[model samples]
Target: MKGLIVRIAAAVVLGAAIVTGSPGVGMAADATALIRAAFDNWRANSSESTVTMTIHRPGWERHLTMKGWTQGHDKALARFTAPAKDAGNATLKLGKTTLIFNPKLNQVIKLPASMLAQSWMGSDFSYNDLSKAEDILTEYSHKIIGTGHAGGHTVYSIEALPKPGAPVVWGKQQVKVRDDGVLLQETFFDQDMRVVRQMTTDKVGRIGGRDYPVVVTMRPAAKKGQWTRLDTTAARFNVPIPAYVFTRSNLQNPRN
Candidate 1:
C-alpha cells in the first residue's frame, strides 16, 4: 500500500503541476506562480474517491477496481476487488511502510526496501513513480524548448534535463502544456531522444469542486497494445474521512 500510494501521489502531483502550471509562453515568469495557484485550488480540500482501472494489451487484459479514501497528500487506502488472485487484498500506503493485507494468509505483510523501478500491476508505471512526488525543479532543470501539439491541442514544449549527480529516471522529458498551463501529455526519453514511455490525461472536469481529469492513461511509447487507464468516479472534496479508514486491519476486515 505504501508503494502504491507513493506512485499515485507522484502521478497526481506531477499531473496536477502540469495542469495548473501552464499560462502563456510569453509570460514564462508567471508560469510558476500560475501552477502554484492551481495546485492550491485543487488541494483546497481533502478528498476521497474510488478508482476503476482497466489494463489492455495484445493478448491479455485486466480490471482492477478499488474503493479507498485519502486525506491531503500523504495518506491513502485501497482495496482490490478484481482479478481473483488479488481479491480481498487491502493496502494502506502511509509514509514509508506499505502494509498489505492478504486474506488468503489472513496476515498483513509490510513491504519496505523493495525495488523502486519495477512495474506496478504489470503496467507501465514504475514503483518509484507511485509514491513520492518527483522533484522535477529540484532534481532537474527545465527550459522551454518550443511549442507543440499533443492530443490535437496546442502545448508548450518544455525540455527537462537532470542536474549533475542526480539519479533520475530517463535522460530527458518533454512536456506538452496547454495555453492555460495544464499539462496534456508528457514523454520520457532516453539519451538519444527515443521515447521510453508516455503519460496522458483526458476527460478533464470539476470533481469535488476542483478541476480534475477524470481519466489518466500511461503506456510505453512504442507498444501497440499496452496501456493502463484509470477512471475516477463520484469524487467529493473536504469530506470527513474516518481515522480508521487508512488502517491495515480495516482492509482485511472491511465489513467490521
Candidate 2:
C-alpha cells in the first residue's frame, strides 16, 4: 500500500497531457487526443523531474524529496533525496520489471508483476499505475459527467469507469479538465463509492513550446484522517537521460 500511494503521488505529476488545438473538442474527443499526445510526446523525449511530499498521519509528519528521469513510456528511475530513512532508496523500472534499491541493505529486490495491483502506502494509486504511463481514454471509458469549478478554475467534469476485465485499479475516477484539455484535478473512488484519493494540479506553464504544469498537489479524500501531500516543483522534457538509467542492474551496481 505504501508503494501504491507513493506512485499515486508521483502520478499527480504525470497525469495531465492535453491536446494542442482541439477547439470545440468534446470531452471524449479531447480525452482521446490527450492520451495520444501524451503517448507520442513521451515516446520522443527523455526528461527529469523533482518531487516533494509532506506525509501527515496520526501524530506523524514526514517530508520526502525524490528525483528521477523518464524515457518514453516504459522506462523510469527515481530515488529519494530527503528524510534520512528513505534517502538513497531508489525505484527503477525497465520495461516490465521494477527493482527497488535499498541503500542500507546494499541490495536490490525485484517486485513481482502481480504486485502492481497493490496499493502504495494505503494511498489512492496502485503500484502498477506507477510502472508506466497510462492512456486514460484508452484504458477507461469516459463519460462527460458534468461541469464544475475546482480550485477556483473552470473545468469539464468527466468520470472514467474501467471496462469489464480491464487492468484497472480504481473502481471509478473523476477528472476535471480545463477547457484546453489539461486535467486540473482528479478524484478516485473505491468499490464502495467512497473517495479514496484526490489530486490537484496548479501553476500551468509552457516549457519548450509545449503547455505543461509546474506544480501538482495530491492528498487523501477523507477529511478526518491525516494524509500526504506531494508537490512537483520542476519538470523538464526532451532532455538527455543516460541510456542505462532505468535498468535494474544499473541501480544495483552504480557506477563510481
Candidate 3:
C-alpha cells in the first residue's frame, strides 16, 4: 500500500507539470505568429510609397519628399524628389548590401559595414535601420512579455533578443503591436542595455484598404528636441514592381 500511494503521488505531479507547461508553449507560439503577421502586413510582396520626411533640430528644420519602392524586404529603392538640392539622391538596398547614388558626382558609393550606423540623408534613421526589416524576424528570438491597453487598442508587448551568433547590432528590442496587426512602437537598446533610440507610430489610419501608421517618428534617446518624422502621403501594396528598378543603374537614373 505504501508503494502504491507513492506511485499515485508521482503520477499526479507529472500530470500537473504537463498541464502547466502546455499553456506556456502555446502562448509562445501565438506570440511568434502575431509578430510574423504584423511584419507581413507592413511589408507586402511589393509596395510603393510617397512620403515626406521632416528632420527637426533645435535650431532649424528641413523637409524632404521622396518616393520609395520595395520588393519584399530584401530589395528597396528610394529617391529624393523635392528640395532641388537633394533631388536625384537615391539609395538602394539589395539583401545585405546598400548603395547610394549622388547625382551631383554621378557616382554610386557602396556603404561599408562601418558606415551602417551613420545617419541616412541627415535623418535620425541609420542605414542599418533602413535595412532592418530584411533580417529582423530571422535574427532575433521574440517573446511576448505582457499585454496592455494603448491608444484604445489591445497591445501585445514583445521583447526581441538577438539569437546566438546573429550579426545584429541591438542587444534587445521592445515592440508594441496592436491586435489588428499595427506596430505601435519599437525601442532599440545597445549591447550594454542602454536605450539607443525609439520609433513610434504617431498616427494610424486606413491606407489602401489596410490599417497602417500614416505618420511615424524616430528619435534618438541621447538627443533632445530632435526627431525625424515620416508622413506617408500615398501607398500601394502587393503591386508588381519591375526588377530593374532595384538595380544600381536605376538608382542613378530612375525610370519613374
Model 3 CA lDDT for position 23: 25
Please give, for residues 1-256, the per-residue lDDT of candidate 2 as tens digits.
0111122235322222233444455344455454344333322256566767666668777777777566766676766778888778776766667677889999998889777555443433454444334635556887666676644544677777788788766788776666555556667788787887776655566643455444455566665566556555666667787777766667867541
lDDT of each: 0.55, 0.56, 0.65
Once fitted onto the true fold, the runs of candidate 2 whose alpha carbons sit more than 4 angstroms away are 1-9, 12-29, 35-44, 117-126, 129-132, 148-154, 202-211
TM-score per model over all chains: 0.73, 0.76, 0.86
Span of ten consecutive residues with least summed lDDT in model 3: 8-17
Which prediction has more favorable lDDT, 1 or 2? 2
Instruction: Please tell me which predicted candidate would have the highest lDDT against the true structure.
Output: 3
How many residue pairs clash per model? 13, 10, 0
Better of 2 and 3 by TM-score: 3
- Compute the lDDT of residue 115 as modeled in candidate 2: 78
Spell out the clash pairs found in candidate 3: none
lDDT of 1: 0.55
> Candidate 3, residues 20-136: lDDT per residue as tens digits?
112233244355655555554455566677777788999999988877776655666777889999999887778878788999999999999778556778877766555344345
Clashing pairs in 2: 1-119, 1-120, 1-121, 1-122, 2-120, 2-121, 3-120, 4-119, 4-120, 5-120
